[model samples]
Target: MNGCLTDWPGFCRQLQYTGERRLLVLSGEESWAQQQAQALLALSAATSTLWLGDAPAGQPHSPTGKYHTALGREYQHLVFNAFSGLHPDALGASAGALTAGGVLLLLCPPLKLWPGFADPDLRRYVALPEQAAGLTSRFITRFIRIQQADRHVLSWQQGTPFPTLSLPAGTLWQGQQDNRGCLNPQQRHALAVMLHSARTHTPVVLTADRGRGKSSLLGRLAARLLRAGKRIVLTAPNPGAAAQAQAHCPVPLPFIAPDTLLKAPPPADLVLVDEAAAIPVPMLLTLARRHCCVFASTEHGYEGTGLGFALKFQPALAALHPHWRKLHMNMPARWSSTDPLEPLLFRLLALNASPPAPPPAGELNIQWISRQQLLNNDTLLLQVFGLLILAHYQTRPGDLRQLLDAPGMSLAVVFRQRTPVAAALLQREGALEQTLADAIWRGQRRPRGHLLPQSLAFHGGQAQACQFSYERIMRIVVHPDSQKTGIGSQLVHWLKHNTQADFLGTSFGASPDLLAFWHHNRFKLVRTGLAADGVSGLPAAMMLWPLTTAAQTVLPVWQGSFAADLQDEGRNMPGDLPHPVPRVNEQQDRQRAHDLAFYHRDWHADRPALRRFVHRQPPCPSLDEQQQRLLQAALIPGADPVVLAREFGHAGQKSVISALRRIMQCYF
Candidate 1:
């Protein structure tokens, strides 16, 4: 006991000398762990310590483990009281907040109990009928295994003395001398590229790993632009993230949310977007199209992957701005390159995960990979996460936790020569009883997880839509090199045939290309949300493929009622929303559609069909400018002839009808 107490301070001094980050996990009773956490902080030479998680009352100022942004600040030590609850996102966010020579103290129960311990976060993605207790401990099991494998990790068991920690007084690392407006050569070169792009009015894509001073460099750029009296507008997923770049600026930089900025662009000589990957692609395009912009996103961190930015958004960006410049910062800004925590965090979270090598030229085979199998195999796990990151930049650490533990989540990967070429994440949903389905349909109860059924019941005007089971595709991704080769479509087809569900459905932020792809695969158009999705800043779309006879029979009724509801909210509708599907094989319906599309034949007779067809198909690209606007604006059921004429620059109501008729003829 005397020797252990003496060696505790010795470990702290070693950390200070080496400037290395360390992790100390206290696994015991809550009170014991809390006391241990405080004791370590007091013994260490840490000047600033941020305690995260629930403080045992009286310490009201102690930081709770909220999903706060840690970009603009640094702390010498951070105490994570996992005894209260483990927050994956909170942990990931604060990972970089600790500077070198700091310790991340985690307080939790013993390793054996951890796997079966019902974590608070397990309920986040688990929908109804899947309780947290029902979820496997696969995520926690892997987490424990990884930590146990790390010899450096300090572990403490309940009723047991603290594990003796030995520290080596390692040599310190030094970064390069300060260059023009940058701390290192990489930042300096990146700044020069930005300057050139600014002068040439070329768009810029700036990316770097976390702690690489990407935000710091942007701050320097912002300061320079401000000194020149240039108009600068800053934006990010949220104001908190933008503050990191603003920290380097001499003046307070105006920050706007990405969604708001897209809706109303401010005047600016240069627009700098921090954490660009968090914003949806549609909004990013709008910003890029309207201004000379620099989009800076992190390559990897606790937050998520910016590698997906390269795989998904870059191609679209190239199409719009061919002259866009790319810059990457290579060196760490605050911590040493030899920081152990950096690599450990990457390994623990799979933040540095990379996809499989180029697929061999062989037949593709689709197979389901279980969560337990993924937990057991590191290579399989990395490849799965890598593909997820490549497909969705918003793939965060929390998602990794959910992937291994959340109930009803299944993965299907298309393999070629034993390497993943395409992958799909599917979640079982719906299967609601009639009583609950009725309540949902009537707007009395709104449950989580069963997104498709809930949308169908509430928005699609059919309570029976919730009676059937559905396997919903959460995400689908094909290798960047293998994309556009029908691999994605093939995977979807395979899922549809192999899955034993009443229907195979999907919900996503709708885009023209995406909608077309699903439509081509025989999925019918359903509901397009009335409000823009918080994540994508685009309207959500629901589409379904019926596998059973009952699903087919009920779908037709859903189409009519949902179509009526959508037309009621047409003023706020997105351009991507095609009109609802018109009932097929009805003579009156065909006549109405023909009359409305060809020449606004009889406004009274074709009102229903016209409304359905107009909202059913996407905007006509082949139509001339005036004709397209005319079709877009005035052809709806309740469109006012005079208002339509003045708004769309059309001749008159009669002329509007005549033009719509010609337009409908092409479409019909």
Candidate 2:
């Protein structure tokens, strides 16, 4: 354990021979771990090494908080100091950067006591009132168990030397460059598909697991287009994600943010979107319209595993562009396919969590499962967590921790022949004391774990709202393969009869289709954010189902108040001063509306008249649900045709406008 630890160099040589990576776990005190890491660093002979903790003053280090910066950058050795904090995201992202012939040095407490130690990272996610006092983390227990059993993982004890290496044989295919510089036929095929899309203005979605060269292929395609004297723009979730693409491209390509591209799309023959999954799907749909582009994303691992891009964007992509192409790069450019670390990382992070084979067509089983049960059952835990991951864009390992350890957490999973198909994460809140309710209503106090009641009292102007108990549906997700099968609605229907809280409710980023789903499930809207949220760019809507008569009577009054005030308008309308809209003359307004709706086609010209036109009864037959959705979206303050098109199953903005015109024509 002393000296230069000469075995380190030989260990790395073994990795190079096999074309694989290793996970080096240094378990013991921080002092002992740091010494071992320093000695290994001196002898590892790696050109590129990264430190993920408090390093010797001058080493290349990555703070756990900024794990994102390490992504898209390769290193031969990564020294992760778990004593600082065992951040699942940072660990996963950092591990990814460990290319073939690399080792991830995870320094932590001795295996036996590691789980009991208070992880600093947990403090960020383990919310207040959710004490971690007696809770045992199943995630850490499973992680350690796997590490000990794996031949690839070398667990070095405090006083002992590094474990003997048994490097598995893995293949390393040298990519021979063609005229286009493709490494293999698979990559060449992908590049050709992208080229065709660029030429014909067809949309393309390219997916891959981590370490696959999707980003590199994108760069090669960009270079090829540049050779053809084509205008190309590259964009990603952030700059770091675009590094690999930029580094591979000899020609300098301009990088754009997704938001900027959405607001003002640059004129380009092609737009290359790297890390497409990290960006919201709504934005992706808008970008899909702007240019013939290749949207490349990691199919799993780190921030992209939610399958949000695939589940939400691809289906819509197919509908919008029937000729849209799909390509998945299976060959790993950075490591061999049989790399032990890769598969281990996948299971450790639950990156590969997916529904098992679909159960035979039959009745589904819905059952309540406790967090304690989740802690002990690995199969159930992964299925439940994975379903949540598939349904959301921001699902992370911290969420898994919260689900397992947080107070008031409950789970309802739907199974078909023992295979999990859907899951709902529920939390209980509200029923505050009179004094605390008054304080929350007066903005004097903010209690933890009561989002519904706090919103109702603090913003909804309902003083007694906090006194009513609530069961909140934190998250609900149905398997992607089995969706539109009424499984999600079934889960909601089950909750209606099961909950005893005064109010059963949920909060979410509002979309037309999402709102309609809630409405269909008997939830009434109680609060609406006036403006779109800055980060998500989606309006916030809260809906509640009243379980008691008192809640039933109070919720409607709160909705009326919300309707009148237009709450988020407070930024512009300061001092809570009411600015009433003037009434339009009925006869003249009707005539003006007629011109706007049927002939003029300018709803903006006579605003009051257009409002009356939209709100008043139509001369023609009743509007269907589809027509109603179109009208609602059209009336919203800043409805974009691109967004409306995606929401309403239209192919493009022009199609959305045509639909709106038809809906308005009904008024005439």
Candidate 3:
């Protein structure tokens, strides 16, 4: 594709070789892209416009009717000025709006020439050839590279006569003057307008298409503010975007990450936000919480969308902070003028102005199922765990084993469609001895498993063993898509229904969200205790819920032993129980039968690994001792000798009898 500006006169002559349908005028602000668009509209063409200002402050009533001008023509151009910045989608959507082989004209300067000009905002400009090629690639059918042209000067500015279109010898003087001067006349006008905004907290926006000197004005403003001891702070989406200000400023400016702005600011009086349009609204909320700030953005051209900027964000700013001041720089100080690729750049990168709202409750589909179900299917397990990995900071392979083997561990997954969208890991607790119960109440060991001696020492508790029942919750992760959607509450309710345990409990890294969720569910705050997790080193809460009349029977016994254990601290031991001797009852019969079946099935299944995994966790209560206690508790129900001597591992019948009576006292 090749052509000269003067190769044709008027619209008809230009259309001879280049169809008037799609014309590309590479003449910056002066480019005839708009003029050529008007000419195409005259011939009943359809057009999609991308303006580089913020999305039209609010919805600006677009020019109506199908015909271009008032001539009753059929051409209808839907202009989307992506004021925020360029968008790839908006560009594609815009191009698609044109008729078959409908013209797509791009207006902007080449990338190579931008640096030669002295504009500080040259960083915002995209390489014209690359952007044009990308657009052509995306909308192949409609966009054909009809022509490519280049020159030292962008467009003629009245009396400049070197070659009809080229700049005159003295034109460089004007360029030099605009480059180093303190905010050109147009920039000064914008800044003065900023002072009128009622919002002293106003964001002074210096917006324009690429090469319009937005950044240069920002740098000049920073230098002036800093010299005035106003404590100017300059920031951008990244350090590279702020490079111009950093290089041009007399003082060394430190760059900070956009995320941690609120807590770690370096005490500044004025904040200068460069390339403000590229950042989303949440970031603007960050700025609003600050003292004073200036937000500078590129309106149209190669930088980003002009229409989106004017339409989407400006009103948000107006409503959120009605006093914001807006300044638009209409003059170009970089290279000669605007880059031709601005329209295409805006179209592709700045299509959607904001994110769509979350799906409504009625529209949301939630699935509830157990971990065992997920584990049986390899695909289901992978999908569930994969979602967790994405949502959580830490989830490991060990967790899968824990889910399968841990006696108390269980899971409930929430699904959107067939996809598991959220999951929670639960731990169903087992009975605890008085000594063990005491240690837990005292915040002694983390999760009680690490403190084994405490279980063997306390001799004054028998009935405490019967009533102890609890369940502990472990990791609870929800999909990012469904977070804050009451899905977590749904999981909690599901757990309560499924487990039907006396008490539900858990300890985890303390987060406000987690804490609030639990608190909302009537999970009371009990005493705090240590529960070692990977991230949080601090102790977590120890809570309980009593389900049966047995709780009334056992609470006092456990409390007494717990108090005594705290007093004893490390100073106690009980005589070992005699060799196990079994007695029988219905409960014992059931437990013995269940255990025997489990052992035989495990042995026959040849699953030594699973057996080991289970045994290693919760240390399956000494089977022989367990059988002896079951037999004794069933036959000698009132006698402490049975529970104490067998379960507590006491050597003599006297001590066992004494422990049993003490525990029984609480129930009586």
Candidate 4:
């Protein structure tokens, strides 16, 4: 007690230095902090105290003893019991209630609690002190380390009575208004349904195209929750989306960090997540366990994981809660419904746009070639490279290795005279046993042939036998010069007809053309993900085609397994994890923007305007005469001077700016 009391005057002085403001006591019982809080309250009548304990005035059944009445209320001093595990949102809300220059007190572990009680399935990942520090750092201006006790004078039984809090204003959100912003009726409707629904556990999903108002809807719902006196926490791929939602809500306290809300979650009434597809499925599950939450996502866009969303997220949603509602918004919010830009955007994305071509009725002609022979040809490599570059924002040289070495599948190409007209890259992917399947789900990166054994060792949580096989499309490229001649569709038909595997699967960056094309080819919607591939930082869509009746029979079983895991356990269960998609750049830094434009939708023919832009620009060292010829061949209509200069030759910075200015002239 001597050491604890030694800093009494210093504590009072520190509180005085912080001035007459709010104080948050986070479940720690320290003699010094108690004395300091007492001294401060005695000295200044303006200060008030908030006590969060296991048994409150109301809510007797609350597991954490977290009372809802204290939510959204400002307090001069809010303290937690030494053993309380506050809800994350409540912790954030409590922090928000603090005035500027306010002091927050924290104390943890009465020694008697060391090696804290463990559970059968999962132990708490965080501790009380660590949780308190996380909240203090986010909302408080400064922290003064007070004391750490050696042993415990106070003790209580496990689950005796320690309650958490709900912080509605702790999270910071920022975004434009709906009237001044962009959103459609379906998007708005989905959000409203989530907002007005009963507070009981019910999952909700909002899926749409890029610029379709999904994120905006989340912001609107968060605002409604704030006004309803609920403690709401908003999270996204980054702080930008989180802040974007906070801007719409006027809650007094909203939390921003993961630890702030996750460690000691306050009593949260609702949570709104924007760009849900962009977050990894594991993190999404962790948040969803909170009970009442709304997730907004984009389908078949850059930010969404495309097939990952369909194959993974959709089932996860189905298993997330007993009653989950869904809505889709298709119309574009940024451009006109019939804008010509839509077609161009779709082409640039390489999404599901083309239907599969039919097989020859009678016999093989000069235009047709055997799949085995096609694999031997080297000329089709250009199409492969170009398509890969086009579909991804950052396809590295390593991907080329995977394409060349993928398991199974001989290749095929169709030619018009001497030049290569179209091409398709295919592989065998499924029919794996539980061991191998679990490994893939768990995330054991492997080459095509080596996938089985390595996955077996990784997934069983120990060594086990594995047997699985399936055919997958490694890459499918149609020469840009002859894109619309129906070559792309022919490739789809050939793969389905030729593959020996029961199920046919393809994983690639999602784009509008690719999504619609697969849908038309009888490939059902499975998953959606996010990425910054096609200048449309929307999520990608993943779909599957079953080539055999046997495969179809097991498809539902596979789906059931995934759904069960998500509901009962949350996130990836067997060895698979949900990959995160990239988001759109709102800050729009100029350099990153330029790089994004090149990596986005189109690498070769993504240019919107021709003449002024090409001729008046600086050039990259990578572009040579042969590349220039290829570009010229790919450009529609004709390449302009500005288009060439900006896209090809090396001009000075001034010329690049000039070319840019010229391109902007078309929009006007």
RMSD of each: 9.6, 12.1, 24.0, 29.5
lDDT of 4 at 249: 53
Model 1 per-residue lDDT at 197: 84
Cα lDDT tens digits, model 3, 1-668, are: 11433332333222222221233333333233344334433453334333322222342333221111211011123332221222333343343333212334433333233223232121122212232222211111111111223232223222232123221222221344444354357866664554433135466666765445566566666665666566667777666567655656676566665666656877777777776655554465567566477777654322233233454456766777776777777665442332223343332232212212234343334444554564455456556655544433333222333343333345667655455667766555546556545443322422423121222112222223323466666666676667787787777777666665665665544445555667677554332332223223334443334455665444444344333332223221111111112212233223222332332211111112122223233433334554444333523313344444656677766555443333222221
Per-prediction TM-score:
0.80, 0.78, 0.32, 0.33
Can you write out model 1's per-residue Cα lDDT over 229-317, one digit (the tens) per residue? Answer: 88888888777787768888888688888778778888889999888876666677788889899998877644343344665577888
lDDT of 4 by residue, 409-440 (tens): 34555545444445555554444567434544
- lDDT winner between candidates 2 and 4: 2
lDDT of 2 by residue, 1-668 (tens): 64435556876876776668888899998888888788787887778887887776666687887887766677788999987777787888788778888888899998999887776665554335345556556667777876788876888898775677664655544534678777677888999888988999998888887777788888899998998999999998889989989888999888998888888887899999987877777788888876788998877646643455765678888988999999988888777766789889877777766667567587899989887787678787887787887666667665766777566777889989888889888888887789877667656677666888887766555557889999989898888778898999999999888878898899887867777788888787766655565334566778899898988877766665454444222322222223333223456546545544554333322333445556676444677887887777776655577888888898998777667667766775
How many Å off is the CA of 167 in candidate 4?
51
Worst 10 residues of 2 by lDDT: 568-577
Residue 198's lDDT in candidate 4: 30
- Residue-pair clash count for candidate 1: 8
TM-score, candidate 2, is 0.78
Q: Itemize residue pairs with steric clashes in candidate 1.
A: 578-615, 579-615, 579-616, 597-661, 597-664, 598-661, 598-662, 599-661
Task: Quote model 4's TM-score.
Answer: 0.33
